[model samples]
Target chain A: MKKIVIITGVLTLTILVGYFFQHKNQRKLTLVEKSDFLQAFATEIGQLWRNADLEGDQLCKKALNVDDSYYQCHPDYFKCLIDKNLIDFRMKKKKVSLKISSSYKSIQRPTHIEYLFPLKVNGLYDLKLRLKDSCREVFLPQRYYPFLANQRDVTIEWDNFNKKVFVDRNLSRVWEVRQWATKVKNNIVLKKLKELPASDIAINLEIVEMQKYCSYQGKHILSAKVYDAMSLHPEDISSPEVKLFRAPYFPWSRKNTKTNIFKIQKKQDITLTEKQSENLCKRVYAKNCTSVPFQSYSSLSSTWMGARETLGGVMEYVTNTVHPKENIILSSKYYPWSSHVHRVGIRGYWDGEGRSMNNFDFGKYPIQVFPNSLDIGFRCMRFK
Target chain B: MIQVLLILFTFISCNQESWETSLQYDLSSINKVNFAKNYLNKGDLKNPPNTWLKLATFERVNKKKCLFYKTPYREKKGVLKIVESLAGKCSAFSKGRVYNDNFSAFRINYVSSTHAEKSNILEAIYSTGKEQLALDIPLINITSPKKYERYDNQLDFSLVPDVSFGEESNQLLLENGKVCHGVNSECQEVVGYKCDKCQNGVVEVVDYNCPQGGSKYCGPNKCGKKNQIACPRGYKILNTKLNSLCFEGSPAGFCEPGLRTYCNEKNILICL
Candidate 1:
């Protein structure tokens, strides 16, 4: 009886020890490993969210046998997703995995799985969630867990369902193809324009300046002064008695006398008002012609050589306006002699003056406009 | 006994899954010259791969065929002894081609049997020594024109006068009593000179011998009419206006000679 009891106790002890050892040896997932898995899961979810719309469109096309011309595809899109089970997703903590439904026969699974952890979805998290909401409405009709929304800030170990998730490379390929098509279209337009005969009007390539300063909207700009033909002749020097007086040469000569003539004389077009100047430019150039904006003018002046007398001189009229009755004007860095003086009872007022030219500041004070005063001028700009 | 067996089994499994085989290389056995030649022949210089070996050969030395490769890792302060010992083993066959006297170049052939072999070669080269070349090149000073300076006119300064009246109409006029009509005006005829209408209260007269042989003088009464008098002093009619009509497209205004005046907006003369 004593031997039997001792043997039974020993067997129980041995079993307890063996169980402890087995549990200790079996590797429980660490916090770091769980975090890594969550990161990869988030990345896969992001990719799936992004491709959901494209996938829906493709599926709708296949089901209805219609091209993009067909407008009513929303109902068909949802039906296609349901029919193909493309959005029938199962989420868990153990691993994130995806399998291309039989509908996507062209997409093949990658041989080597990339476990890119700590995926950077810094600024795109909200956008992805919004996309997921649209995708969720179609696939998951039931309410999703609230904790999933806050997963970025919190790490929770979900039920360990053994699965592997992968992002569909076809989604990325579709994106690349669309991007390439746009780039090719732009290149073709540029090539056609370049192949045409060069215009006599000096078109300066301000691509770098446009990209840096003008928000990449314009590639080329008119280099020669606007209303160049109306510029005063260098020989028409105004005496100090008529220094304040300004006017274009009589009958407006078409010859460009100001091209190589930079004298101390009053030059540049100062006769026309803003509306008149703009109309004149539009009439001559026809399209893509307008008064030079302060931004474009400042940028061009900053880089161009011989900008002072050619691009500057006089309070040049610009497109920017501060008041209803006033428009902004720019002057050359070298020549600040044209002061913005105003008289109260004049027909028009000089609204502002940019004396320094470098700071790009326009004065807000209204000044009188003399009938013969020709301190203000404007040049037109052409855009590409 | 059961617990001991479980622990051993667990350890063996973990070892099989996690253990990585280290790469090994015999430096002496590698033919440095042949490796370098093969690397260059593979067009690695033209199209380089993203690797430490390619990065090394990216910097081309001026006036020299050799390339300077810099190690990515920071050199330790006390590794000079080890560097010297390793550099002593660098073969003489790679002189001037792969390395100079100061720099020890390692030719890492990426087209080896396996990725492990390439990594092994990279590791071997890294263990040798870190060499740095200090360049004392002068900074290029570009003399850009002053931004605020007036733009120089392309016109020849020598040809331009300080002050010019620019083709005065009087300079083109013939001397008094000289025939003043038709081509060079060498004959006597009724000479007519347009009056300056802009001069408000001025008058002048010009006496000329006509083809009929008697002298006739035109005065202020003839202003704004046919056979108008010549402009008085300080007043002149623009040749442009003489050839066409009076200022502002009006033909009925006239004035004496040598009078300073201008046309008003109303086509009337305003004396300056």
Candidate 2:
């Protein structure tokens, strides 16, 4: 039998070359070795407002050195956990060793990378190809290290290939990364938006905070999206916490109820009357987010403001660079009645809910292009 | 070192696949005088230098029609030399003197061609490298690409998540007024300072917390902490802003702590 097909092709090429040299020499990043290169993501209080002078969890303890003191107990690095709302880290670990010269110096502070998978998860289907040939062996050497980490201004995002790991100026950077990006250290930009000359996309561009009028009727990433001034309720403010006003949408059924927009959150048209929206859906929590009662509009995710969906079965781009009119909006719009930063003057509350990852205009001076301000977006959804 | 091994062999021959969908030009000089009048003709070239022009782009080869040149290698002031060739042999890189020593990680240089009046010669070399690299070192990222993605894009250095690195003009050392142009480093705190009066976000220094406590006044652009209302005597703070709406901190009438929460159901006494 041809010696049983040459010993099953020499035991599948010696277990795929000894499982790629034992996960490239026994994986160094560990907690208990789960290797395929260890993937990770955690950092949203809105990505630490990308850097409008960082406040909340200070851009993830300065990009993941995590209040350094020498790896804060390094097994291989990454454990993090700041949590007041979120800063969680752990792309399974490995990459701490620094001293600067000796005494563990370390404070040059600036390292916020996240994704570093390099391959070797039992040969992902034992190298039988396809999974875009095992995602081009971790993004074809990251398309040549994100243009040598962008000629040193370093922003290396071959779409977080090898999962993620940007750690500027200490290590784990791409394209020579020495630190400097995020629109040059923290003007916090992502800009691309340009088109302007609307007859009526729904109309609204007040600027300091108002724009989001004609609901950019999407032809792609979800169309009928709306989100009203997120669960309004200032009712002419006095505060016991605005006496509690969560409810934005939900009707009948599991009943705890919450619905209010014209009756509060001041923009005015005045609609609530179902016993003044049930005396404010009996105070607090509220999450069904607008299905009519007084909602003249408030649909996109409803309140606490969030939603734009359809990153179609979620993300996949290592230069697929897909652009169904790419969205994720929210650059700045929460310091008015008080989330803080309105005239963009600045205090705290670092850009959360002000949303936008790029398009500039927080304290001005970035211009090359920035016309269209709010269309309200936020893509990427697949979790299944 | 031979332009760092020809830029590390043009970054490992940019992992092949015909340089992944070519077509990346940033030509400019009237697209190199209409690509030297369509592929080196109309007098095989000569009429480029306003300052300089040897620059090339717009390739074809095989269906035949070329001009890809971009070769310059002695690089390293912060690296950027690119060469990659798969027979499309990337070329065109010339200069006379304009090197910007870590001018925030420089690499794209070509100076010599100017004025034919705006077709955006890389936004006039990125506004002359942000008015000459905003006082040198440790902070240089301000790309300009756009006009059909500027020849495979140039003008995206990335990083501005709360801008820092100016222990004196955001360091690599070189301060004393740190050029304050592309600001951040010597980066005089502006991180989103909006207040021009009701445009609202102000902060050069306005320190916090007033959950009903007073006297704390930060400034440079404006800051407040208030809480000492004796005005029932002659009444001032401008007679409570000429008929109260209580615009200070404004949770709209805050004053909790002790005495069972003094006046908040809109009776508005907000005791300080």
Runs with alpha carbons beyond 4 Å of true place in candidate 2: A1-114, A119-384, B1-272
Q: Assess every candidate by TM-score.
A: 0.16, 0.20
lDDT of 1 by residue, A280-324 (tens): 332121111323422121111211111212233234342211111
- Most lDDT-accurate candidate: 1
Model 2 chain A: ten consecutive residues of lowest lDDT: A128-137
**Which lDDT tens digits does candidate 2 get at residues A60-153?**
3433212132222221222122222233333436331211111111122111111221222222311100000000000011011111111112
Please tell me what DockQ candidate 1 reaches: 0.01
Write down the worst ten-residue block by lDDT for model 2 chain B: B216-225
Q: Supply the global lDDT for candidate 2.
A: 0.21
TM-score of model number 1: 0.16
Best by TM-score: 2
